[model samples]
Target chain A: MTDPKTQTGSRQDEFEFFEESNALWWITLAPTTWAVHFVLAYGGTAVWCAKFGETQGVTVARLSIAGLTVLALGFIGWLGWRSVRRWKPRQNDMEDLSHPEGRHEFLGHAAFLLCIISAIGVVYVAMPALFITTCR
Target chain B: MIRSLAGSGRRLVAMALMMALAGCAGRQSALSPAGEDASWLHDLWIVMLVGAVILWTALNGLFFFVTRVRPNDWPERHANRLIIGGGVIFPTVLVGTLLAYGLSMMPHMRADGDGLVVKVRAEEWWWRVEYWPAGATAPIVTANEIRLPTGQRTELLLDANKYIHSFWVPALGGKMDMFPGRETRMTLRPETPGVYRGQCAEFCGPSHALMAFEAVILTPGDFAAWLEAEAAPAAPPATPEAQRGQTLFRDEGCGACHAVRGTEFDGLVGPDLTHLASRQSLGAGIMEVTREDLTDWIAHTRDIKPEVAMPAYDWLEAAELADLAAYLEGLK
Candidate 1:
């Protein structure tokens, strides 16, 4: 039988791996929100202009940039949510019992959860500013 | 007993401090004049506010009663009826009332009446006010400062030269934009005699934050005297220094941008310096028009305002600077 200490140590290592991966995944979501903001503002205006058959070259270019940005952000947000959804159950299972290495594993899981909560708060605060339209 | 008393005292102090901090904020906001139009739109704002308070109180009371009557451990009870009813009735009433009110108020605001009209043009930094008062000769042009008689209905015809800018004096009325090639009309009245300060609300450029002006609400007698003085051409300066400075002003390129009536300087690009001495402040209400400040402003316009279109007079000697200040002071 594997020693309880060694089993706990392995769980700690798994927890650390999950924590780092979670942080990295969430860091990638920031650029997506910024892109969504620009797309909503500039992209909406450009598409409306294009649908009316107005051939202004600069407007076309701005709209294309906005559309591409929105697509990129959507892709990144999907990837991040997918990874979090997959890893959350494993982290919860590890928290079922305490062992010699359980303390470190639990702490690492808490840190990763804190980061996710903080990221959600940041996005909520920035949503209004990013979506504000300044020009006609 | 002593520890509990001390704790209560500390809590009272904390509450008092919070109240004091709140009072300190927005003291200057009350100094503004008053809004122009009173309509149903304003009424809807009051109605919506009252409705929200009532709804919140009712819901909270119902929630408290239900929770107290039925414990959480009992068989699960659904609040779908309350949620669904509130979801439909709350937003529909709130938004619909506001939309109807706004639509009704828009037309009343646009209706023009037989009031004294003043044409106001917004340039890069300063406001050019033209008094087209009933039966006045060619509109009297002034900059930054506007003087009007109390208890008179005045219509402002606002126009912007370049970018979009907003004209707002919160005490009097809501903000109106000075859109390029479009004329916006705003009506205002001052019920009392006081000085009201206003600034450009829309972000225009680098100095946009600093762009400010004042509305001087004066008595009819003072307004008449001011108009008469403004109607007349600028009086010639008496002192030798002033005369010499007048000659210097002509020779220098100050004439190229600014206009001094009854002189060869007829450029209308800058502020009218015909009654330069009669003004309270200068530099678009940024600085007092003291002799020293005027001298510095004339010598280095770029120093006071970065990237200003007005060129600096680098060639003026000490004596010329002093004489010019004297001459400008004598314009009143």
Candidate 2:
């Protein structure tokens, strides 16, 4: 016969897995943003330097922005990985410990919302300014 | 593990197949060099590619063998020492040898003694080349096309008049950047008697993609004749259509973007049309100077080339277009 506590734990584990999976997907935002910024900044600067043959103050600014994106993305990936790894075990052992469902659920929801909002912002605000043609 | 080896082998095979396909396709681009320096560069690249293939195969083979043959939990706790020693020693030695070899090749690439000098200035969409011979007080300023005598070593002093750009001709040598405030030198000898096309390697603006030039290497006699022809003034048009076109050229403000020597047309914004009839292609090798192509281009340069600086002359009648085309073609 299965223990009632173990059954409850399995249910709680399922819920936590759902939330953590959502959070992990949400964490993809950090990497996506970083990658886009990196491509734009570095690629744009390279083009600018090549075309004009002069490195102005603006080129330095763009390159620095690219570097920062790399750093930020790497840090975010590390943090997200740590969070997900910790969450896996915590979800598995949920009913054994005190019910701490509220905090994990809230954070996961927040991350999901943030990701959606940022993605929308990128689509609406950034792409047009960066890619539209005016070459002469 | 076996899958990985298979995958790498597949990649190698795929690369080889692609190279074979490229060879068979016969899409010989016009911009490639047929000269000695270019051939040397190409050979060196092939050698390096072969070396890379061998190295990659050996490294991957070693990795595959080690992973496959050895158990995961081997008792030998540390192979880190050997790895660290090899990581430091081999790269240091290899890189040093490469640097030395590259340094040895540099002097030959940079001609030291007296050579033909061509000053190249990069604008937004065109190249202005000034050829100055040894002991000459004046230099011949030409646009788009650079004619050089075959077997003559020429040193190009390259710089951008407005922006950063790179000068490259695949058959001549590698690329060198043209900085706004700085000048970079490149040496090349066109040993072959053929046209070598080149483009602005750096992205400058919208028209950057279309920016192109050519090096027309000719026999000694032909080159001399070309030089003499270029030094002479613009000749009068022979045909009635050409005469009408010349009048149209004056009336229609064609003088705004181009310059034809010994005429009132003195606009420096575009290519010098002084010897327009002499060139094989119009608008810096964009298209052939055929009657229909010239009419289409002159009628609507913007339509043909969206980002071209030249405005369209769509207002002209068909008769006018033909006359203009005839006149421009007779500018030789």
Candidate 3:
């Protein structure tokens, strides 16, 4: 059997490397998608409205908004899927207070929850395009 | 204790009822919806209020149950489920549905450009109203009072000459901003024939609180008659005293700022006074349109409305002031 100390040292090294490399950026992946959706929706509508008066820019602006919404939803959904995969708990993760991978598991669980929320937010944000009649 | 609790509850219910009833009593009340747009807004407000009450009650009930009824520690999985379901799913669904419903109603609130159009310019402390009748070369210029045909959708082209202002007639429709160099539009279709009050919804200056106007909705025939009368020049001042007042109006340099059609005082710096006497109020609805009020406004405008653009004519003799008031009041 491998030495227990060596195993612990390797695990510590992995966690440190993960931290240094900023591998946990997936934690913010969901919110980042939301931010992108918000900016594009508002900015696209404003630019379209300014370029083509209220009455004319309806079609292109709305189509673009719809496309962006779908893209954001898909991206967040993929992130959620990855988070779910990462959140597979070890046998004693719940009961083992000193579990080495507990932090990673908790981060994965939080990221999954946030991704679900962000997906819902993306859908909610996109709802304006579905109903708002342009330049009315 | 039970009796006292019941009494307190009854009092609370009574207070709530009174508060709700108060919303319906004001002339400038969105709750007292007199048009289709205002009705939609009122209905939306009620829905949001109901949603808020439900959320408040549910959250407080949950809090009470968790703290007082069952104080045992919940399992981590159950807590997590509650957080995700309540914090994430519930609010997202609720707000999403509201946003969709609200956005869907936006088109109906806007005009189809199928009705009469009125151009309104917001100045420092007054409104310049121009009525665009069908097939008219020049818009019939008026001020302060807006006359509309009942049951007809009328569009207002709103602009600001100086600072930004907002046009709002709460009983009729939502507010639209008046931005400098940009014209915004809003439509109103009043269902009833009555006088409604409108106020400058945006704070623009020191006298913003006093900037108000009247919307007089009338039958089609009455509105046409009013428009015809409004389009005409003021009848020449009749009495010798009135004539003297007219001469004084010209001599006092009032012609530099005020315009009385059919007279030499064709100034555009101030409100048109061709039919000023016909209006319901003066100083933009701050005072009743009367000889006494007009005299007071002319003599002590600064005292009455602080920081208004019109300077006080306190130097005019009492008799001259009376003549000016009579001449103005006789224009109708």
TM-score of 1: 0.60
- Decide which is better by TM-score, 1 or 2: 2
Candidate 3 lDDT tens digits, A10-115: 9999977787345378798899989889999888888888889455857787888899988898888888887766666544345442455566666677788888
- Candidate 1 recovers a fraction of native contacts equal to 0.00
The residue ranges of model 3 lying beyond 4 angstroms of the native Cα positions read: A1-16, A19-21, A89-100, B1-20, B75-81
Q: Which ten residues in a row have the lowest lDDT in candidate 2 chain B?
A: B24-33
Query: What is the Cα-based lDDT of residue B164 in candidate 2?
Result: 88
* TM-score to true structure, per model: 0.60, 0.63, 0.92
Q: What is the C-alpha lDDT of each candidate?
A: 0.66, 0.68, 0.85
* Candidates sorted by DockQ, best first: 3, 1, 2
What is the C-alpha lDDT profile of model 3 across B101-198, one tens digit per residue? 77878878865645578999998788999999766678999999888887788889999999999999988889999999998888888877788899
**Weakest lDDT window of 10 consecutive positions for candidate 3 chain B:** B107-116
Per-residue lDDT over B207-322 for candidate 1, one digit per residue giving the tens place of the 0 to 100 score:
78666777676777788788888878999988999999999988887888888888888888888898878876777777777889888988888778766677777678988999
Using DockQ as the measure, which candidate wins? 3
Evaluated on the second chain alone, the candidates' TM-scores are 0.79, 0.84, 0.93
Off by over 4 Å in 1: A1-136, B1-78, B94-108, B111-113
> For the second chain of model 1, what is the TM-score against the true structure's chain B?
0.79
